[model samples]
Target: MVTFFEASLDKISVHHVGNQSQDELYALSEAPLELKDDVIPGLLMQYFLKPFEKSNEVYHLMHSSDDLALNEVHHFATMAFEDESKFHEASEQIAKHLYKVSTHPNIKGGELYVAYFNRVQIEGNPLDAIGIFKSENKETYLKVYPDKGGFVVDYEQEAININKLDKGVLIFNIEKENGYKVVVLDKTTGGQDAAVYWKDEFLQLKVRNDSFNRTNNTMGIYKNFVTQKLDDEFEMSKADKIDLLNRSMKYFKEKETFDLDEFAEEVISNPEAITSFKNFKNQYEEEFGYPIGDSFEISDNAVKKQARVYKSVLKLDKNFHIYIHGDNKLIEKGFDDDKSMNYYKVYFKEEA
Candidate 1:
């Protein structure tokens, strides 16, 4: 979703925000940090931008009143984007707002970094962006140096892991009226209770229902229908379920556009099952209060990402696991009355 191949770090402010429920205070820097080393900028860019390289979901800043000017993070980001002089001060406001929302007891106090970036690439367009990051977890590292002939182990120092960003959001300069396009990551949140404050309360993000998200969500819904809901309404063996999942993935991979009716006839191929599946998809929209159109363009990136988690394994007790990939018809499930045991038979023309 984002890259920094042509990006440069313009300005950054560091602050310490504490949990409000524990009466911890927030400390802010008066000015932005001076980048003394040229290599330091590159490392900072990696820390800020690398996590978002594989992300496909995009979001926008929003408020309850539907007013863009009232969103704190969006407002501060706008200020910095419009005038470079306001970057440091805007960072201060962002830190304060984060402190105000860190009210959950499980929320840990940590270092917050608000940075202004230039020429950050999103969707192949190099646009200016504002990045807000927080490090809530740390690890101890030991230094080994040469002392005489042998190396000496030095004292331990606690530091943040650049590869493990706990929380982050990158707001692009485009789409000002509909809340600037945003991408986010949060790795250290312990529970949903504490998780909402970061993306929901602090940043106030809404998932952009574009091709990527629509494609991703639709596949997810179908996967749920096959793996979870189908068993309640119909009697389907594990092999049948795997076959259905395989068919769904095949349809997505082979087609450029997705139509509900087409998918049902091609993948499900049963009148009653198709109606049940469509109703299940509709329930998700109604329950979640989101609309998914009946047809839309498919996103290959979303399909690839979703494929990683789709299960193709069928486990039989603790003894064996059948990996169903090519043809489900080749496997057969049977019960032996004499031994009173369940068994599966496999058929293959050749063995690797």
Candidate 2:
């Protein structure tokens, strides 16, 4: 579990891989990211910082090497120190956005580096780009963000966007096979059109998939299954289904991670219901072609957002809540002839 924190940058630099248009390669000295009391910078950090601490995996455009993006960043940054003039203008653009993102009310400070490359080789061609990066570290910090009057604080972690960078790549310190988030922004004809790398990866692992997303999707499917069985098939009492849903939510709130088998054993403890769930899971995977993983990092935000789907209530003057989750057809809405009052006619096989 990663905590939220304010993001601060320790060093920043720019590199200009010279073209025939420019006489010599240039670079910017490593400097601090300092924008005191700026709104845009805070917002910029808030947005960019959200993806930090997600995964350490570095993502790249090239298929040949794992550290291709990492190497390019280092190469360009090193060159920037030689001659700073070539990259000064481009560095300003990168800085403008970084400051904008830092001003977001929720953004906490963290150490980050902004590397600008005037021109870097990509697929045997040179392209102008910016590299936003943060080195790997085990330190965690108290994250404080602006509020209505004051602010709030929490723990924080770090990560960066990789699968999609506008004509660029975001590199992380983590290394895994085909495990990176990559983005490619189109800058042809002087227009900035961004495209995510995972869109065309064609490989499952290469796609921009994460445990949080996977868990949300799986929970959505499970909700649908419950809906089908309860609303359409009438396979169980609505009360039971609602109870199960509530219990499942509690599990998600309490546990940091989810295991399919453990969920079956605890949440859906009945043997027959568990069997039904397993069968449905198999059909679900076959139809969707997306495996419901054995374990997942539970998303509390997603769980909170999905809670509305489980709402069931009978209202009376907005003062009383009568939970009627059983068969609605068994209770008929009507008016009592003598009392002239609204009432319900309930049908049952036996009267207690």
Candidate 3:
């Protein structure tokens, strides 16, 4: 299957790529060096076809079919290719940086592919695209140009396809950890904002800092704790759920690091509850194949991101919040003619 597309990707020609940015490029590149050539092909296939978890960083590129941000990409790409010189300059700078990355001793080099697309039509709309793909287990960087040619791309793979490219750049694999990083320069509306995506230890740190990954992981544990640890004899009031979420997020906000013991002491401070939490955490680690560590840095962004997950609500006389874990099935909204007000009916298994 890849063989059919390989020829198309190979057809795109390489352009002039940058200098000085060479040293800066090292910080941005990440692809493992030792993987077999076949490994990369498989990874690429998975990236294009597999549905990424919502929490994954690459979810937008992998799953988003249309959005304003995506449209902006097409606009920028169109402005870029309009002026042949501008297109060449941007393409050249990218190539130069990539070349530097390839030659760097530490960048266990891998194949790099930069494909130019005038525009890809989606849902009766033409959107330009520049695909900066590294044939490795890394993030795919996308650049969308404004409408130029009216080419409809039914699938994402079609846009990233190499064989159908107007121009391309390929660098052989040298290191697996450092492949090709994408830099998008959009000078379309005089606001020259460039977005760059690179994968490395640093990028992972950034992801951690956002607590994006943490929230996702912690949310899962929280749900399990609620389901398994709390006995049916003990009915969890909305207050209990609120306290749990508030304290959990408070720990992330106030603490410099995550200590499981410290978290239990400060947040889930109740002795019996803490014991139950510890048991749940241990069982979760054993069954789920990952340790809930004693320490980790707290991310404010993550706390904010998980505000909805916490869903702590303040109740009023006639109305009370029906906070849920993003599931519509858990609650239903209705209107009352007797009271002439709206109401929510919560669905949960209550213990007598």
Candidates ranked by TM-score: 1, 2, 3
Q: Over the stretch 1-352, how does candidate 2's per-residue lDDT look in tens digits?
A: 1112423322244332211222332233344345565674545444433343342222333333545333333333334433555344435444333333332232223233464333233223333334454222234567799899999998755433333222233432223233333433222221122112112221112323456556666677677777676455445654456567766766777888989889888887877777777788778778866676778788666666567666555555666665654555676666788998776566789865
What C-alpha lDDT do the candidate models reach, one value each?
0.92, 0.48, 0.42
For all candidates, the clash counts are 0, 56, 40
Error of 2 at 232 (Å): 4.0
> How accurate locally is residue 189 in candidate 3, as Cα lDDT from 0 to 100?
20
Better of 2 and 3 by lDDT: 2
Best by lDDT: 1
TM-score of every model? 0.95, 0.40, 0.36
| lDDT tens digits by residue: candidate 3, 293-326 | 6566655555565565555663646555444433
Tell me each candidate's RMSD, in Å, in order. 1.5, 14.2, 19.2
On TM-score, the stronger of 1 and 2 is: 1
What TM-score does candidate 3 reach? 0.36
